[model samples]
Target: MKEKTIDYVLRATWMAVSKMYNEEAGKAGSTMATGFALLSIDPEKGTPSTSLGPKMGMEATSLSRILRTMEDKGIIVRKRNPEDGRSVLINLTNFGLEMRNFSKGVVLRFDEAVKENVSEEDLRTFIEVAHTIMELINNKKIYKPETSAK
Candidate 1:
């Protein structure tokens, strides 16, 4: 990978990671998205249905499909929010809790492997760079719509 652009590196790495996660999740009859959603929900307290999408960094349509699948699989159930009758809470079923534990283990194992291979300083720098990239994107620095109006 000589002279790879930062975008290329980012996309390539993420694609690889996504593939790896999907493969691992497949062994348990799941997808990476399902695993991620499972990990996002609180085991005991549950999470707001609306918040699940943002928490998982996905859009409503995408999250809706995953939630539907999870519901069909008996992994999750929607309950009325005790605090807000207008809102719904996404509660994990007993099976969901077990799946969440599996997801946690998978993520921890990935983290452990990375830590074992990458030096502390390198990992810190990686995180720093990632944050900076996210900040730039969030701030619309790369594609300034305001400036483009001219």
Candidate 2:
């Protein structure tokens, strides 16, 4: 058996989620995108999918479709950007905010449960290493060393 690592362990953990949330909230891909967008958005700018797509490693068309679905589900709303008429600002609906909070609570409880069994220092180190791995994977495309050149 392979030892649990970030990729395998995290995937397996999420794959084990059998709980059913509302269709609007249960979409893992959309939920994750919304979570990250909430983090990256400024209360002032309100966030736009155009800015969110690259950050979330999603395509423009895919993001658009996701946003549309979310809107139809009443999970989110879009408004024209005041500063740029051509752009739209994404805002969470009341239900959307509640869903975000609920998802966050689930994650927090899971973390606390893990902490109950692990040393604080070990948890800190594990998180730091995980963050480093995530940073590398997220920015892999930005590496520009011409290593194959003769």
| Candidate 2 local lDDT, 11-125, one digit each (tens) | 7756655232223335544465555444444444467757878777778887787777778877778889888899888887776776567666656666777899999999999
Pick the TM-score winner. Answer: 1
With candidate 2 superimposed using the best TM-score fit, by how many Å does residue 52's alpha carbon deviate from the native? 1.9
lDDT values, one for every candidate: 0.95, 0.67
Residue pairs with colliding backbones in model 2 are none
Specify the poorest-scoring 10-residue window by lDDT in model 2: 17-26
Off by over 4 Å in 2: 1-45, 135-150
Residue-by-residue lDDT tens digits, candidate 1, 15-103: 99999999999999999999999999999999999998888889999999999999999999999999999999999999999999999
Winning candidate number (lDDT) = 1
